[model samples]
Each structure stands twice: as structure tokens, then as C-alpha cells.
Target: MTTQKALIVGASGGIGQNLVQYLSEQEAWKIVGLSRSQPPLKSTAQFIAVDLLKRDDVVTKLEKLTDITHIFYTAFYGGPTFSVPVAENLAMLTNVVEAIEPVAPLLERIVLIQGGKVYGRQIGPFKTPAKGFAEK
Candidate 1:
């Protein structure tokens, strides 16, 4: 069986770090962690320091990950204003996708990680817990 390779972007964040650990334990997975700084935990996974805001940097760094099968995108860029964060976060995610799609021919899936902010949590307290939009 062919080994599955996973690229975890924003690997230094809480969710990203956890994913790195989980994937590292799976014998069938080869893990690659991408972030601005190396994660504090030690693991067999390979680490790449990359600024997702810069398309050139993302493209250059990710081009060699030709064996990647999946991408877990946990990277987030926050700003004081809502619009700023929205724009920057989108740009970062776009950079990663654009960079990987062309070079990683084996890529099959991309997972985007989002939190309560998507339900307007940042604006104010919610009357009820945030749930998936499809949930009634």
C-alpha cells in the first residue's frame, strides 16, 4: 500500500500541533508541518518554516511536496478589525491551495479549520452555542 502524506499548514498553532502528533502516530502517514515557527513538540514529522501571506514563499517551499495526499489548513491571521482578518485569512488559505495544487499531483483532499468566529463570536456573545449552519 502507498503511504499517505499529510501537509499540516499552521502547524505551530494548537490545532495544527495536535494534528501533527496524531498523524505522526499513524504508521501509514508521512507528516509535513508548515508554519512560521517550528512547533514546540518533537515528532518524526518534517517541519517547514513558511509565511503563508507571501505567495512566493509558499510556492517555493511547497513545490517539493509532490507526494502530499491531504492538507489540513489550520492557519489563521487575525486583525483588530473584522474585515482585515477576513481578507488576510482568505489570502493565506488561497496561497497555500494555489501553491500545492499544481505541484502536488497526488493531492486529494483539503481540510479547512474554522472556529466560533464563523458564527459571529468575535462580534459578541451568542444566545446559544454555535452549531453547523445545516443544523436546526
Candidate 2:
């Protein structure tokens, strides 16, 4: 049986941390976590300290992980203004993808994790339940 390897970016955040814990319990699954700080919990997963903002650093750190089967991208960078965070977050995701694509030939999927902010909750309040399409 082939083992599934998961590379989780932003492994220290709430969602990322939870994922690490969950994946660690599954059989035939290997976990590799990347974050600026170490996650609080102890697990079998290997952790790598990486600054997603630095392209060179990300490339240098992640180039050798050739066995990764899936990439769970949960990293986020916040700023005083909205635009700054948007650009920086995109750059972070790009760095991870560019670095891993060439080295990890077995790569199958890249999962992007997004939260409630997509509904503009950060800006202000909206309806009780959000809908995919706007009401006419």
C-alpha cells in the first residue's frame, strides 16, 4: 500500500494545528508541517520553520520534500489594510507552489483553506446565514 504524505503550510494556526492532529491519527499517513513558529502539540509529524514571505527561504527549505502527496495551505498574513494581506497571502501560496512543484513529482493535490472572512465578516456584519449568490 502507498502511504499518503501531507504537507501542511501554516501548521501553527488554529485550522492548521487541528489538521495536524487529525492527520497524525490516520494510518498510512505522514505529516509535514511548515510555520514560522512551532505548533503547541506534540505529534509524529515533522515540523519545519519557514517564512512564507521569503521566496528564497521557502524554496531552500521545501525543495527536498519530494514525497509529498498533498499540500494543505492554511497560511495567512494580516495587515492594517485589506489589500496588503491579500497580496502577501497570495505571494505566500505562490512561493509554496513554485518551490514544491518541481521537486515533488508525486504531488497530487493542493488544498487551500479559507475561513469566514470570505463572507466579508471582517468588514462588518451580514445576514445570519450566507448564500453563494446574492439575493435579487
Winner by TM-score: 2
Model 1 Cα lDDT, one tens digit per residue, 1-136: 6789999998998789999999898889999999999989878899999999999999999889999999999887767765336678889999999999989989999999866666666677777767643356
lDDT of 2 by residue, 1-136 (tens): 6799999999998889999999999888899999998988888899999999999999999998999999999887866754336678789999999999999999999999966564556676779676422233
Clashes of each: 0, 0
What value does the lDDT take at residue 136 in candidate 1? 63
lDDT of each: 0.86, 0.88
Relative to the true structure, candidate 2 reaches a TM of: 0.88
Each candidate structure's TM-score, on Cα atoms with residue i matched to residue i, is: 0.86, 0.88
Clashes of 1: 0
Q: Which pairs of residues collide in model 2?
A: none
